[model samples]
Target: MEQGIIVTIDCETRTTREINLALREASLAQTPVRLSNPDCRHNLAVGVTTPLSVEIDGHVGYYCGGLCDGVDIRVAGDAGWGLAENLMGGRIAITGAAGSAAGATMRGGTVIVGGDAGARCGIAMKGGTLIVGGSVGVLSAFMMQKGVLIICGDAGEALGDSLYEGKIYVRGMIASLGSDAVISDLTDEDAAMLEAALGDAGIDARPEEFQKIVSGKKLYNFSTKEKEIWKTAL
Candidate 1:
């Protein structure tokens, strides 16, 4: 039962149900639908999504599309916290900006932010790819185990804390590192990955210009001096 729907944010239409109901009304039942005008709030669309293509026309609240799967999401404006958190699969794109912790602990899929992003974007990411065309705030991609975080602009402080097996790419500046993050040279494979992701996100760039951030291989056992040094290394 796939459907197509439209939603516009307002005061009376408070609940995310406004979006969901529109989808359902358009004959969507775990089906394909289109949504628009999700204002910044909380949990705009945060659960089982299927075969839907949501096109948000403005800013969105926290936890937008958190835990969504089998859907294609596109944002014409900015986003809030927990964007696509724990998403299993599918694709989400933001044309404007985002708030804190966008794509926190996401397990799979792809998220692209065209403009700047707030703090802790891609925090604890286990899998998938988070692409930001502009700067990101502090602690983005902290404790991530797998996947990739690619930023085309400047980065904030305290990134990749206790991260295990993921790759990060920043084309601009970094402010700080987390528990055991380190600066690394981008390998050929890493470059290929970056180019591929960027291409998918419709960003035109050179992979050779990007820098990769990796874990220090020492997840535990840290000294204050080392922490201080790492902090400065960012």
Candidate 2:
């Protein structure tokens, strides 16, 4: 274990601003920290960059750990919208469920949800990996251009809708595939990637059970003949 300084802040007495300030100070010192009595406050620990660890003892609201880099953040309970949105690096984990747009537009690092995730999970993700140990809601991975979204359980309707180049893997049922998205045969490389991802997340799912979803590439170019069809792809 890496020995480091530790600080604890009580959210009950402090506003989110104060808590964030305290975290900033602690991170600047490269110290590990703990947050107690978090009452689902939005944007906790946003934009923190340090090689340290942060532990939230309870739930957090929207955008917890957003834009994080070079830190490890763990939430003990569920999270609201956009957890880890636009993340640049490092790792964030939710021990419970996550709300809409989890990992939205993230360019790097990893986000792991121990339970289910809501609508638009991994929306427009540019890079990195998102692992959901449970089901995902509708419109998951909508308009995703890069990266990987992995669902160990069922996926809701329009999964990967209008996706550009991102990869999606589901171990359970998919309610529907969105426009220009189709199931493809899992390759050996995909299995290796899935295994590594699940292992990194400490999830026990088997990669063989996962079905890969990728863009069909049928709508890469516009044509007058397929103008009506292109509308759905958009």
- Candidate topping lDDT: 2
List runs of model 2 lying over 4 Å from the truth. 1-4, 224-234
Name the regions of candidate 1 deviating beyond 4 angstroms. Answer: 1-14, 21-31, 220-234
Task: Say which candidate scores most in TM-score.
Answer: 2
Q: Candidate 2 — number of clashing residue pairs?
A: 0
lDDT of 2 by residue, 110-218 (tens): 9999999999999999998999999999999988999999999999999999989989999999999999999999999999999999998999988899999999987
In model 1, where is the ten-residue run with the lowest total lDDT? 2-11
For candidate 2, what is the lDDT?
Answer: 0.91
Each model's total of backbone clashes: 2, 0
Query: Using Cα atoms with residue i matched to residue i, what is each candidate's TM-score against the true structure?
Result: 0.83, 0.93
User: TM-score for model 1?
Assistant: 0.83
lDDT of each: 0.80, 0.91
* Position 60, candidate 2: lDDT: 98
> Which digits, one per residue and each the tens of the lDDT, describe model 1 over residues 33-92?
444445465676567555666666678778888888766888778888788899888898
